[model samples]
Target: MLELRPGCECCDRDLPPDSADARICTFECTFCVDCVDNVLRGVCPNCGGNFAPRPIRPASKLTNNPPSQKRTFNPDCFPASR
Candidate 1:
């Protein structure tokens, strides 16, 4: 099961369970679209893998399979200027 992490690991942006902005690597290292497109340049800082849009869990299923409350913030993952 996907952790459906609650926020972008790079920018700490809020990415709710259903947010289309969420992108994740094969390892499920989550980030926002902005960070993936601009800052990280389609690369995952943690795993050095390409990112794909995270699948949104259905609202009905969310009740049974809750999204993770953990927020992984790695401000140093990329340069701020990028």
Candidate 2:
């Protein structure tokens, strides 16, 4: 199951479970569209893989499988993994 991470790993932007702006790499490293497009250039800083829109879990399902409360932020701006 997707972790449904709560925030952008790059900018620490609040990415609520249903946010369309959330993008994720294969490793599920999450970032906002702004970071993916302008800052990261379509690349994931942690995993290097190109990002795709994170799937929005259905509201009904969110109750059963809630979004992750754990926030992941990488402030060091590490190079992309790939």
Candidate 3:
């Protein structure tokens, strides 16, 4: 199951499970559309992998399969150590 993350890892902006703005890498490193396009250049800063729009969990299934509350924010500035 996909871990529907609650926010963008880069900007820490809220990205609820149904948000259309969420983007993620193969490693599930989440970011907002703004960060993914402008800041990240459509690649994940953490994994150096391409990003794609995150899948939205359906509202009916959300009760049983809730989105993750465990927010994974980016604590470091950009140009993180390679």
For this target, which candidate reaches the highest lDDT against the unseen true structure? 1
Given candidate 3, what's the lDDT at residue 36? 84
TM-score list, all predictions:
0.95, 0.90, 0.89
Per-prediction count of colliding residue pairs?
Answer: 0, 1, 0
Q: Give the candidate order by descending TM-score.
A: 1, 2, 3
Off by over 4 Å in 1: 80-82
Q: Is candidate 2 or candidate 3 better by lDDT?
A: 2
CA lDDT, every prediction?
0.94, 0.89, 0.85
Greater TM-score among 2 and 3 belongs to 2
Worst 10 residues of 3 by lDDT: 73-82
Give the Cα RMSD of candidate 3.
2.7
Candidate 2's C-alpha runs over 4 A off are 78-82
lDDT of 2: 0.89
When sorted by lDDT, best at the front, the candidate numbers are 1, 2, 3
Which lDDT value does model 1 have at 79? 79
Better of 1 and 2 by lDDT: 1
Worst 10 contiguous positions by lDDT, candidate 1: 73-82
Candidate 3 residue pairs that clash: none
State residue 36's C-alpha deviation in candidate 2, in Å: 0.4
Candidate 3 local distance difference test against the native: 0.85
Ten contiguous residues with the weakest lDDT in model 2:
73-82
